[model samples]
Target: MENSIYQVYEDEIQSLEEEIKMLAEKYEDSQQESTFFSDEEILMSMKSFQTEFQGELKGQESPSDLKAQLESLEADLSFLMKFTGIWFTSHSKKTVEKTGSRTIQKHRLSGNCHSLPFQLEFQLLEIKSKESVSAVITDLNVIMESGEYSGVSKFVSSTEEHGNLLPFFKSLSSYAEWYEHRRCTFLHFKTRYPDIVKLPEGLLGDYIVLRNPEPSGFELMIVWKIHVDEDGRTTPVLDLLTKVPEQVLEQNITTIENAPTCFRSMLLLFGIETAIENLIKVVGLKK
Candidate 1:
């Protein structure tokens, strides 16, 4: 039974590694295609289509030609949905009668990123009075029902990014990607070293405690945190917390204090598993 459980964790690690690779490739493809996440990009696409439609109308007055053009536009919109994992439920545009020349369009969209669902509502304004056309987004609101991503909730309540939707989506994907990566990594190590590692709060928790095989009551804790900035950049921060016995602390105060920084440098040069394994060996040698 114990062997089977270990196999299960190994399997999950392999699966997560595969998924991470797939996600990276897919996101890169989306970026290369320039998924329309910003109002400015959308505006440029809309203007291009508008110009093409006008030329087509002047050249070919046939209803069949117009239907074909509409079909092409629909296909482009479908590509946008597939690339960004976003789907629009309602989209409408109207010319402000009072303004006489301004166009205001409202959009409602919802989508799932890495299985996390979210909704967005916003308005796009196009100013045609100036010689240069510009797109402005306003009244933007974000809704994420799932509490799995706490960072998303803070974004939903904050007004800082209400006018911009690009960062919200970008950060959401990045943070969730890192979260999954951390969970997989922790699970893999815990299952591999069940006798040495302890997870006080299950696999979903942020920190894992490692104890040597000897009953010296010495412990090393690894804390992993995912931080998302206001600009929607996601970063992973790792720290080492040692709980050394009084005797050991007094005997080797320098090693206990220097372990954290050395571990970080090892993480840069050798990676997580080797760094952790080396630490385990060092602690296991203490008699």
Candidate 2:
């Protein structure tokens, strides 16, 4: 009976080892893909696994033996989770200057891909109890630049709803990653065909003005609008403007079908591949 019990424990451990190895390999493979599991999901899974393992080992092995095995597994899990592409896993936390009797904690996560860089910040108000704590996404900015085409886009959460910091952090981190991926794709295209593709210039506020090469002295303006629903879901709306009244009258300034090939390609980089369709649907643009 003693030998059989030991064999069972050994078999369970071996099975867990195999599972961990498979997860690690999947994590590695996902890095090269466009879509992968979010960091929050992966971390939560690791935590759940840890809890289950602890419960399974309790009363099954000597206290010392359980502690040693738990520590080993935890260390391995931590290492794996760090490389799972979650920005929060590598975030930095610092205490900001106190305001009156309230203390503030600032956590920041930042990353860049080539010329595109992004930063997400969370400001937490520390209280006496964890339940009284509150956090908000203070800043979310992504800057993309290639030659004369450079713009800084910022994300603003509409509602002032404050709650646990973990969910907010996860959402912002995921947004930053998505922004980076979109920027990287845009940069790749811009780099490959520099002469053919030119970035819009004179970007001010939420609008970009591009000098139309074909029409000589004509400029195309692109406007950006972000809509945040009650549920905190964000949708991007794009609009186009032109100084020439005749183009508007003709209803053919820059329809998706009639847009410059390079311009159309650049719009795909903005995380809105169907920008023209969105502009038409949302803004009621004809043609």
Candidate 3:
């Protein structure tokens, strides 16, 4: 009876082990199905990511094309600028030309003649030269008949008797230095500027140089005057004088009331201000 009980108990224990193995296999299979679905979701996410990436790439392509076009246009503009010598505007060019022409006319009409009508102080009008230096000299002549000598003078043509006297006047070339440095030429100023003299006919000052004093130059004093008729036609007269007043040297005055703006600008640019300041200090302190 005890041996039969042991056999029945062993069979019951073996059956229970088999049932536990079956339950474990079913749980593992269910876990595997859930894992497969999770993998599928991850794959879908990867596809959506790739689609978004492709859209962004397509959008960037259009902007890249636009950027390339802009670059090409800028290059063309640069090339065109180089090809054309004109970098400024047409309006600017016109304005500059007009201003330049007006300045030239102004200077031509009221330019400085070699001689000042009055005396200048502390400044020398003497010209230093080696050759038969024909000095472009100016002298003050009074405005009156040939016999009467008083008042300012005006422009007058050279007469046959006074032919030899014309040579004494310095060549325009010497005075040309003054004009060349300023980029200007002498315009028979008598015709343009009437205020230089006060006369109706014939010039008052003798624009002549002395020839007898060979190789040396002399300064002639002259006064300026103007003469006008009933009509607008004007005549400039100059009177050649023998001597200028000693007191004239005490004060120097310029007939050209103003300086050119271009010259003024250049002076400012070329450190003239500093030089002037230094000069003032030296002169003021030295005394």
The order by descending lDDT is 1, 2, 3
Residue range 1-287, candidate 2, lDDT tens digits: 99999999999999899778756755554443324567698668656765666645555664456557877987886665465444223456565645433556566666542223444566666554446654344433322232222221222232223432344344344544544544553354346434322345311233444443344334445655443333434444455664544655355545533554544455766445455333323322222
The whole-model C-alpha lDDT of candidate 3 against the native structure comes to 0.32
Candidate 2's C-alpha runs over 4 A off are: 1-84, 88-161, 192-197, 200-210, 215-217, 224-230, 245-271, 274-287
Worst 10 residues of 3 by lDDT: 100-109
- How high is the lDDT of residue 104 in model 1? 67
Candidate 2 deviates by what RMSD? 17.2
Answer with 1 or 3, whichever has the higher TM-score: 1
Error of 3 at 101 (Å): 43
Q: Provide the overall lDDT of each model, using Cα atoms, as 2-decimal numbers.
A: 0.72, 0.47, 0.32
- For candidate 3, write residues 41-88 as lDDT tens digits: 856754575555554665355544554686698698667644532121
Ranking by TM-score, best first? 1, 2, 3
RMSD to true structure for each model, in Å: 23.1, 17.2, 40.0
**Tens-place lDDT digits, model 1, residues 1-102:** 999999999999998997787667556644644444576885576557656666355555554555578779989998987776555654433332213245
